[model samples]
Target: MASLETRVTEFQENLARNSVNEIKEQIKEMQKMEESQNFVLKDCHEKTQNMLKRIVELEKTDFDDKFNHITRRMIGEVVREHLTPIQMNFNLENKSIKKLVEEHAYTIEQ
Candidate 1:
């Protein structure tokens, strides 16, 4: 029952509708891809954050270990320096006591 002009108009409207539907589908597909990209970026960001934290921890531990080693070495050197004279005095006193005891024993025997 439609004339040529009406049918032509209907054909144009259907073509426009189909084009709009294709555009909507393409937009949905693009949104899905963008969401997937966002998830990947978020995952990578978390991994990078964890790696930075681990690096900081490793640096701190290494620094603390080196500091402790240097401290212990310095303390050992100071202790050795302070104790050397005391050790020598103790050895001299021990020898003097032994000599005095030997002379006393000889006198007592005589």
Candidate 2:
């Protein structure tokens, strides 16, 4: 009877080990799920940023087309508000409102 009791105790210990292994596996699965979700969120953020960049470029082109009608002050305000996020590099080659108007007037004459 004592031997039978000892065998039962050993059996319970083995069952406990299996249960612990299952718990560990579950924990690992949860970790993987969290990692996958993080990757998805990162991808979504990248896509959103790309889309916004393209939209800004399109808006800038449209604004450029109508730049002659907008006053210099209004143009400056628009540029400051819209392009402040990514910023821009300005140099002599980058034309201002007055320069662009002069160039357009020259084109019309020629």
Candidate 3:
């Protein structure tokens, strides 16, 4: 009958309208996620560049290569106790932990 055909057409039209709206909503959500990821990546990149610049500035300073290696004897409070007697300040960016121990070792030898 004519009434049955009319109802079926109306139902199909409603389904099509809802499907379009659902697709639009999904696209909007995906765009927001991409924007957030881009912002985080840019922030991390800037922080890394700043750290590299600081490292380059530090390498220009004088560093002692001797006695910076840490042995079993250098563990714990003994390391701090020896470093306290020196007037020198440690610039960790300029040297490794081993190099720092070498500097302290040379100081002890003297």
Name the lDDT value of residue 86 in candidate 3. Answer: 56
In what order do the candidates fall by lDDT, top score first?
Answer: 1, 2, 3
**Candidate 1: worst 10 consecutive residues by lDDT?**
56-65
Q: Which is the better candidate, 1 or 2, if ranked by TM-score? A: 1
Task: Put down candidate 2 lDDT per residue, 5-68, tens digits, no spaces.
Answer: 8999999999999999999999999999999999999999999999999999887786765676
Between prediction 2 and prediction 3, which has the larger TM-score? 3
* Model 1 lDDT per residue over 12-82, tens place: 99999999999999999999999999999999999999999999998778777798999999999999999
Candidate 3 wrong stretches, greater than 4 Å: 65-110
Considering every candidate listed, which one attains the maximal lDDT?
1
Candidate 1 residue 21 C-alpha distance from true site, Å: 0.6
Single out the weakest 10-residue window by summed lDDT for candidate 3. 64-73
Off by over 4 Å in 1: 63-110
Where model 2 places Cα greater than 4 Å from the true spot, the runs are: 63-110
Tell me which of candidates 1 and 3 scores higher on TM-score: 1
- TM-scores for the candidates: 0.55, 0.47, 0.48
lDDT of 3 by residue, 23-99 (tens): 99999999999999999999999999999998997786445432344344466568778786552446453467778
